[model samples]
Target: MNPISIVLVRPRDPNNIGACARAMGNFGLSDLRVVDPYEPVWRESVSAVGVNDIMQQAKRCATLDEALQDTAFSMASTAIKNREIKQEIVPLPSLNERLQVAPEGRVALVFGNEKSGLSGEDIERCDVVLNIPTASKQPSINLAQAVILTCYELSRRPGFKAIRHPGQAPEAPTDAQKEIFISSADVLFEKSGFKTDFSSDQRKALLRHMLSRQGLSREQLFFLKKWADKLSSKLP
Candidate 1:
């Protein structure tokens, strides 16, 4: 497997940082880097549970540039798409595809703050932008959940190869991919004249559950994105 590092920038929540450490360890990824963290809570390892060792060994840096210094490729994770960045804002599955074929070089998955997410400057530092894709009404996901979802999606791809029961079917959409598809669908909802005041996160969560049950594939995801784009273009 290629070397992959998880980089957190100005992370404000201690529990979320710890949970990210645990999530990394869950998928056999231990290289963690924190940039300009205000509290340094991850150093104490209080929230990581059995993966405290991973947190203990994580590196700390004074800036995002410093944290990503050794990485050959970097991806910025954000909830909102920053129009200023010229880099492609790829969905989670597209990222997985690239990682699967990437050479053995340092790769960093950069995450931003819990509330405002990565700034435009932060996104510019990355080669690509990764959006988890949530509903239009409430397009935010929890920080820890974002880490878990990203790590879990990467783990499901060929490079990570997470172990599974012999007869059990694989998970569909993975959590990250499902979020992108649902978010794409939400773009269509806006075009359909649906009210944007509803609980979109809850609705997307339900859609994710239903899609998981149906076992969606890569081709299906492409089709959905295309359909949504066509629908969104028809709107005023």
Candidate 2:
């Protein structure tokens, strides 16, 4: 089974949620997480044919962070053509290759609400941004359609496997570990008077993207964190 979790952020439509669950079932993708969904109707989606088990067992999270905290890498799906952010933008077709590179942990494919896509903060929480190619005339696609397309493409390689380096390497860093390291680095940068054109948040986001691509092992992350901690300790 693919270690992919389908995450819907603040979904507004019960039917869309049902359809997404159905898509997951179609592709043999089991994990489903809904963040801050519209409470009353989402439960109704359990009635979706052939997906009752998935819908019933879906995890409900209060925040995006909670949904992705344990994942090694998170990809936010966005329909917006042009965004100011500098995170890695991946096309949907190439996602399978991308997943192969991510370290051994659950990968979260995050989608946004039906009316509005992911917020900038939500995008920042993810390691990468996924763009589903569509004509410029109609750039955006439906929420359920996006999930279906992603799951379908991923289903092409049913037995998804991650490629990692050889030799007793440390385990992959979880999202929580990455955040802690980023925070430690942020403190170090601030104390050392590091200068950059990007705001602190933007810099952190860029750092996050870089770390995700680097596939830092847990020991490497700890090594970097220790360096940052030691360096920050000397600063006033």
Candidate 3:
């Protein structure tokens, strides 16, 4: 399997850290990286009670960039959207699709602080932003739960050929491919008369769910974009 790291940035609660460590261990992920945690409270004895081994192996870094230095790809989990940052904001399942293909790279899944999720600057450093689909009224999710869900999604194989060897890597979609698909899908939805009065949060949730279900490939994205363009030209 590919090496995966679960990164927590400036987490406030030791209990949440402990729970997150357990989740990573349960899902066969061994790497745990902490970036400037509020306190050095994640000792093996206290924080990771049941999963001491995982904690013992966890790495602590002074900064986010330091923790992510060795990673080939990184995804930031954020609840808010920042138009200034150019990184693609994708649904959770898109991460799953990428993992299904390139399961051998050094991939890092980063989560921000409990009170405030990733900032635009923090998110900009990542290759993609993963947003969990949730209701508009209650879109916020617990930190530990978010880590568990993301880990679970990346661990599952979506009909990809199993690679038993260490060096064998699957071919996952690139960031560009994912962005094109999302942009095309958005255009199609607009041309199809979908209402835009919905809050941006709600619209993002709907788009996340729809794109996740479809799992459009690169070729499919191109076709959809072309079709949407043709239809858009003929519309009154």
lDDT of 2 by residue, 1-236 (tens): 33889999999988899999988887778789999998676867753678888888999999999999989899999976667777998999999888888788899999999998899999999999998999999998999999999988897774653232256766999999999999999999899999989888997899999998999899999999999999999999
RMSD of every prediction? 19.8, 23.4, 20.8
Taking the tens digit of each residue's C-alpha lDDT, what string does model 1 give over 195-229? Answer: 75567777687777778788677668768878887
- What value of lDDT does candidate 2 attain over all alpha carbons? 0.89
lDDT of 1: 0.80
Candidate closer to the true structure by lDDT (higher is better), 1 or 2? 2
After superposition, candidate 1 runs with Cα above 4 Å error: 81-83, 101-103, 159-236
Query: Which whole-number lDDT from 0 to 100 does residue 196 have in model 3?
Result: 73
Q: Give the TM-score of candidate 3.
A: 0.62
